[model samples]
Target: MEHDGQLELYTAVADQLKEAHARVRASQVPEGVRMALTRKLLVITAAAKHDLADAARRLESFMKDLDEGRIPEEDH
Candidate 1:
């Protein structure tokens, strides 16, 4: 349900997409708006995943640097 301390945004968005797709498939009339919205949602989720990956890499690098005493502490 949560990741990276406490975050379920990505998971919730994915779950919402699945539910929306089911509705769109069952509707007889053209749900152009729904389809478009779903597409946007897909793009956003994909972007989020990509961004998260980048963040993880940065976090790992930061942690490693800190462990090696190479990371400079913020000026207080």
Candidate 2:
């Protein structure tokens, strides 16, 4: 896939995460548990963001390698 396609996919993922976070924040739960859950969600969201960045970097690198004729041999 091309860079634009990758970017559109990433943007959709980001939008979904934003919507999830908003829903969690808007929940009407007990105070202590709500705060704890919110914090945990924040950490999870951050980790997901990091993972997404890493995936994008890897995809770009792979594309570059392919463009440069660095394809590996297929196993029969």
Candidate 3:
């Protein structure tokens, strides 16, 4: 995808996740249970963000290689 499209998709993903997290936070639950659940959710979100960062790094490297003529561009 083009840069603008990728950015739009990334923004959408972030917004959706934020909205979902807010909804979950607003739901009523026992304090202990809610704390445990929120902790797990935090771990999951952190892992996802880490993976996204790694993917972004790989994409950046790929784009740099292509731009520097170190990799061949496909005839798409």
Worst 10 residues of 3 by lDDT: 67-76
Task: Kindly list the per-residue Cα lDDT of model 3 for residues 1-76, writing each as its tens digit.
Answer: 5878767756754664565456447745455644654554465456556675544444444335434544332222
Candidate 2 Cα lDDT to native: 0.56
Better of 1 and 3 by lDDT: 3
Alpha-carbon RMSD to native, per candidate: 18.1, 16.4, 17.3
Model 2 CA deviation exceeding 4 Å by range:
53-76
lDDT, each prediction: 0.48, 0.56, 0.52
The deviation in Å at residue 29 for candidate 3 is: 0.8
Clashing pairs in 3: none
List where candidate 1 sits over 4 angstroms from the true fold: 5-7, 31-76
Q: On residues 1-76, what C-alpha lDDT tens digit does candidate 1 reach at each position?
A: 3464335544544565565456545545335644654454455456656775443444444335434644332322
Candidate 1: 10-residue stretch with minimal lDDT: 67-76
**What is candidate 3's local distance difference test score?**
0.52
Error of 1 at 6 (Å): 6.3
Top TM-score hit: 2
> Between candidates 1 and 3, which one is better according to TM-score?
3
Q: After best superposition, candidate 1 residue 35: deviation in angstroms? A: 6.0
